[model samples]
Target: MNKANPIRIQRYLSGVDYPQTRDGLVRAAEHNGADAPTLEALRGLPDRMYEGPSGVSAEIGGDS
Candidate 1:
């Protein structure tokens, strides 16, 4: 997996609502256009519910 564009990560997760689990978020990100690296980053995050894109980003090492 290649490195991902941090800014686009949020846009890809647009369809997902808050309180989504890491697995669910990863699926949504895939459905919305996230690449392999982005998916990998999401997968690497701690297993928990995310409140929003920022939460996902923060866990994936973004400047949220």
Candidate 2:
């Protein structure tokens, strides 16, 4: 599968409250209309609270 773009992921994650968990991020991304690959990337995130977008990007190994 193609890797999801971190910048695009962040766009879908805009307005998400900080310190969000992986599940929360998934929900937020879904609400923002993230595509299948984006959701898959989000689902692959470590199950923990994310302090910010950078944390998410770091987890996914992509530059935002």
Q: Taking the tens digit of each residue's C-alpha lDDT, what string does model 2 give over 1-64?
A: 2467888899999999998999999999999999999999999887999999999988786543
Model 1, which residues run further than 4 Å from truth? 1-5, 62-64
| Per-model TM-score on C-alpha atoms | 0.77, 0.89
Could you tell me how far off, in angstroms, the CA of residue 20 lies in candidate 2 after the best superposition? 0.4
Which candidate's lDDT is highest? Answer: 2
Candidate 2 — which residues are off by over 4 angstroms? 62-64
State which candidate has the highest TM-score.
Answer: 2
Q: What is the lDDT of residue 17 in candidate 1?
A: 78
Model 1 residue pairs with clashes: none
lDDT of each: 0.76, 0.89
